[model samples]
Target: MAEEKLPTRAEDFAEWYNQLVVRADLADYAPVRGCMVVKPYGWALWENITSWLDGEFKKTGHVNAAFPTLIPMSFFEKEKEHVEGFAPELAVVTHGGGVELEEKLAVRPTSETIIGHMYSKWVKSWRDLPLLIVQWGSVLRWEMRTKLFLRTTEFYWHEGHTAHVSEEEAKEEMYRILDIYERFCFEEAAIPVLKGTKSETERFAGAQITTSIEAMMWDKRALQSGTSHYFGDNFAKAFEIQFLNKDNKLTFAQTTSWAISSRIIGAMIMVHGDDNGLVLPPRLAPIQAVVVPIFKNDAEKEKVMEVADRIFAELKTAGIRIKMDDRDNVSSGFKFNDWEMRGVPVRVEIGPKDVEKGSVALARRDKPGREGKTFVPQAGLDSAVSDLLADIQASLLKRATEYRDANIHNVEDFEELKQVVQDGWAFSYWCESRECETKVKEEAKATTRNIPFNQPDTEGTCVVCGKPSKRKAYFAKAY
Candidate 1:
């Protein structure tokens, strides 16, 4: 059978996303409603993401621990805002062990409530206040509409919860995590993002401040790549998580929690994928390089396979994740397309002639132009491939950064804001009022992506209400 071509992204982006996600072997619909079965390839990508971030978390003084998946109803009720925010989406467990229970249990949508409860018990004095714990697990949120990784009811993520003696310390921890997330997205995923504080209406439930890293997709819609929340003793006071200060007085500890989820995989697909398929950043690709040996006959096969094996071994020894394809049943054309769809960062083609010439043809997945491929001699081939992978990674980030910046528009009035936001990000001064924010979303289907951290704090008139504003807000149609 001929290989099937995915729907063109320009014609239908949503359909293209769905087809590419499945065709590329990333994930699929689960048997259960509103869930997905993350296949091995998809899980491997997530694993790489987690492992990289995990090191960063540790460097910042976080240690991993697991919390129970189920939370008691009383825990949710402890924080009024949190309960109100998640109540409609809670999945209740009325009967455990096949019998009725007196109090209902809720599966975790996020782990703040439970982790806060634990910290309340584990902390006693100022010495124990800076408790940093990380959990890698799955969370379930009942969703009416579900997309694979973007809005799934059940998904995997790493959530870090910490308590500090002072509000200043807690705020610093929150910002520190946000910085780490920004580095991960830029360096590892090759996805450029806007870092800023979320508007009050969009901030996390029960948080005094919420910051995020938002990345724009190919369709110009924003994807919230990661978030850091500063609770400022909101949950700590609610849960009565009191700790003795150095002055010998009891006070509630400040709290913070941050997370990045499987949804990042979706963001990567949208940001880097092309009509051909997913174009993975070299750093995150499971198989960084795939060696496909081409031979027409037994004699040619023997010689080509010998050279391919040697090259693969050299790359492997040099700490590159690679695979050699020497299947006789399938044509080379099939192998090429298959690997391309899988988004292998680099492909090394070794034919009889190339083997005889002690060289291999290298093709990069990120570049669709003629310059993507080149012939490199086998001597120091491993170093050549490494340099090529680094170039591909950097080029992907440069292209994405350029696109994101170009789509951002500076508009002075609501009318101009609405016009530019139809297909890109609009930079305008917002009054920071719920009424004005809601009006913009209701009329233009755009919300405040963030109040960027580094933008100048100049006085300007609000885009919608014409009121005095403190800073420019990033507005966009988001996922």
Candidate 2:
């Protein structure tokens, strides 16, 4: 089963991703269109992602809670902009238990409206100033086009909603979450990202400010990995979430919402994966290392298995997520290919010869083929494996960062910007006007990804309209 070769990314990037998702046992298409069934392997990967994020949220004083899946349609009307933004995608429920319902319900496209309504009732005094809650679940959007993990009608994520007494506090919360998200991408996922604020036209509906972490994929297209939005008093005013201040005056609460969804898995695959298969970061991979015993006969099998089992136990004791692949039905080569496809960060192979030599063959996933293989003493092998995993993690981040920097070209004019965006990202001065933004989208098929916080001390003219501009923005075709 591992013998079949996938289409090379250079030949067909889209098909390569589509086939790899299923062949790698991550997910499969469901009977329902626009939905996917995440297999156990994929769920384990997601579990690792959520576990890290959940811990970080708790450390920041946020608590987890669940809301009803079905929210009354009327709740959406409370926030006009939000409803308009999501109106086309909402999956409305008009019948329940075989009876036609008078009032319709919208499958939770997002929990903002419902969460706002609940916050209105829960928050009444200055003491309840900051209510930070996160919900972990799936949302239905009725998407017309869907990819395995990137986009789907129903997808998994954790949405965080927080209410603060002041706009300053709410905006701080928004930026704080974006910082955490950027760290997650760098340290855990080994994907370098740019953190910045979204353009007005791209900001979340009803949000005063929207920020995101953008990452460049292998194809040089940008993917919005995570987003954090500051809603000011929009939601609070709409939902009547009023509280008495220190001066005893009533005021609407300032709110923020942020999320990092499963689409991040797609980002990882595109950033670190290769023609061979996935090259997962050690910190986030479900199986950090896999142990395979190589043998030709029963005698060899016994010797190899003894060493392999001991090494697996040692690695597991050292806090490594290890797997023992001692299947007799398949060839050792088959096991290697199988684990390679799964993107286990490290592979430990102990054959009879290695057992006799008191050594094991270590293969690094990030560096494929013989170049990545080495013979290391089995003594203190656990430390050796740990060090290798760390190196691989660092190496992935370095490689991806270099690639991203190399592909971003600064443009001095509209024609140059058009050419740059065809094969890479165009970093140029922008007027931050919808007219200029739309012109680029219409002509070059690129949109403003974000206005990066890191900008030149000196201002320049807009590339599109030649208007005075204060900041530079990334223009790219996005996922």
Question: What RMSD does each model have against the real structure?
Answer: 1.2, 0.8
Model 1 per-residue lDDT tens digits across residues 256-308: 99999999999999999998888999999988999999999999888988899
Best by lDDT: 2
| lDDT of candidates 1 onward, in order | 0.92, 0.94
Candidate 2 residues lying further than 4 Å off, grouped into runs, are none
Enumerate residue pairs that collide in model 2. Answer: none
Off by over 4 Å in 1: 1-3, 369-371
